[model samples]
Target: MFPPTPPIPEELTLVVDGLTYAGLAFGPVDAPPVLALHGWQDNANSFLQLARALPDVRLVALDLSGHGQSSHRSADATYQIWDDLPQLVGVLDALGWAQCAVLGHSRGAIIATLLAATQPERVHTLITLDSMLPRPAKDEDFAKTLRAFLKDRTALLNRSPRQFASEQAFVERRARMGEPPLVSTVLADRALKPCDDGFAHRNDPRHNGASAVRMNEGQCISVLQALAMPVLNIWATPRQGLEDDIARQRALIAENVPNVTSVDIPGHHHWHMEPEPAEQIAAAIRHFLV
Candidate 1:
């Protein structure tokens, strides 16, 4: 089992262009900081388990602008991978951190790569977990996937606050959906907020449908080539067809970047949520950083 959630030193907010990002800080503030970024549909709390495992390091995790406790931007808000750079910069500035390491998962990993590439001086180290360069869209399949992702967002946005006839009903449905089982209990505890109407999802679905900028192979190669920081790329084994892809990705990184290392952790993509594998990930990170 995972350790209990560590006590947060404090809850804080960083306001960027009138939008508020809710976050928590852990470990010693004086230590060289590490920013933790979660994957799509996940929040800052996603890092809690890992944070507990790496108690010696100062860590800051935030709800990206539409997830967790962060406020949703206007419907016209332009959301894209590049847009996140400034937000991250702003967070660092708010914390008075000039340089820090980054640990990102999935989408966050892509963003970290871009940031380290473009702003090499600001990012000292980067670690990507279970992430890959965005797959290039070919023909209609690209459109299909984008449409499906957007449709889910639209539905979530239009959903009315559901009042579970019973807590068991909600639990049963969530299980059926196969939502990451390991963190379901933790997620359930944090997903709801008491209201006059009983309970409502604290997460904003409008943020869910935010527009994404697709990165092609050339773009991905360019970004990796530009990275100057030491990088540790971790892949999850048993990932469908990913073993082959990871081999290619490693070659690309090794050939282009001066300092790069790779590791393949056993398990599925969401290994961080699983207790045993998460420990391995934590151990790997600790070893790499040292």
Candidate 2:
């Protein structure tokens, strides 16, 4: 059994294309809306502390499809990063919002960039944490990657979701799977759910598959070049060889995007989950959004 979650104020639900997307909301409802999005496998809870740190604005952090409590896409649908943009736009439109600021982390940030660049009027400001793009297409062997994607997708469909002895163990299991934080609380916050037999993760396993196709560097550069919004990129220090790549991405954005402000914050990929780093993120957001 899992321990009870401490009370989170303002539970939210967004129904899009007949699917339910669950989230947590904070601050005043009438304030300029800011939609917060979590990364790959991360849920809406990723923004819990960050929302608490920024009470001056309305923040609604949603569990992107197949993560957290959000409904999974149909079996035929792929979980490509670009597929999230229309659903995201639909959510804001359903909320009667013509335009709203977007705050996304890692994979979610890629979606934000896509939205801001392609549909410029729909996004007010763009803020990303830790990553720019997932695997760039330029560096990929598409034939090999597509084959792996098919294999993994088919495998997941036939396999049952993994179960755990207890929710705490499930959280501990997840902590070891990623870039791993020294503390488990952040991942633990949205990592598990009760299942028929035992506790299991909330994310869909199909997400483990390789991308069927990816945005090549040129495509990514074109989008970054078109962005006219005030963009804030709060990046974390990547591990060794990864640092140079992120620096290159940052330089690309700075060169192309008209109004871009970037700052390096401490901690690993999911730094926004911790209080200290969340505060740093909030400060940058406050400065940029203003």
Candidate 3:
């Protein structure tokens, strides 16, 4: 059986610019906070295992816009990798945190990197799990990317939320969508909601559409180079098709970022969610934060 989940996290709501964000807070309220962000299709509970491992460090894990209990962006907006930036800043200001450590997994890791790069003064320590930069696209693919994004967007807009027979079935279906092949029930609970019969997803459908735009390698490099804050990049063994991107970004970070500590650990991309890997990751983070 999996390690027991920590106590039910305290519920929290942060509002900024008329938008409200829902999140879970763990550990002592007085401890210096580490704003935690989850990956694509994941939510605040993504950090549960890690939070349990690091009981002394306060973790405020937010369900980003379009995901979990958070509000979706206005109809005019799109889920670009950078779209969450201003909202995150607003969340920090609302929390009265001028500067604090930040932790992100997958898509969240990309956002944390963007935050550290654009608002260097507000992040003291950066810890990225299994990812650091956005997937880069080539300049020649811009038109194709835009067209494909539009098509996907239109298609998804006309679709209705799909309900599953049971939460377990939904979790199994989700696990089949990617590598590691494991799903946490805690995460499933946060990502799902009861509907007419079984359960419907809580995530915004737009999240499944292709991004209208993406930063190219050169752009990603500039962002990586701009990271002046101390960073702890904890990456798992890359999945089959990710080897190239992983190698490429590691090279870029090794060459450009001066104060980064890169560590390779075992497990798949969501390693931080499992007990043993979470403990290992906690040790690295604890050492880095100290």
Choose the strongest candidate by TM-score: 3
Q: Report the number of the highest-lDDT candidate.
A: 3
lDDT of 1 by residue, 1-290 (tens): 33666556467789976789887788887876898877776777777777778888898987777666887767555456676788788888888989999988888887788788888888999999987466544444556667765776667656665555444445566679765555555555455666675556666665455344466666678888888888999888877766677667667777777788888889876677666777889898889899
Ranked by TM-score, top first = 3, 2, 1
Kindly give the number of clashing pairs for every candidate.
0, 0, 0
Instruction: Estimate the overall C-alpha local distance difference test score of candidate 2.
Output: 0.79
The CA lDDT at 195 in model 1 is: 66
Over 4 Å off in model 1, which ranges?
1-9, 138-174, 195-198, 207-212, 241-251
Q: Once superposed on the true structure, which residue ranges of model 3 sit more than 4 Å away at CA?
A: 1-4, 179-184
Question: What TM-score fits each model?
Answer: 0.84, 0.92, 0.96
Over 1-290, each residue of candidate 3 has an lDDT whose tens digit, in order, gives: 23476656899999877777999998888898999999998999888888888888779999999889998878778898899899999999988899989999999999999999999999988999999988789999999999999999888875777778788887778677763444446677878889888898888899999999989999988998899899999999856788998998888888988799999889888888888988899989888888
- Candidate 1 lDDT (Cα, whole model)? 0.74
Q: Candidate 1 vs candidate 3: which has greater lDDT?
A: 3
Error of model 2, residue 192, in angstroms: 2.0
Off by more than 4 A, model 2: 1-7, 178-184
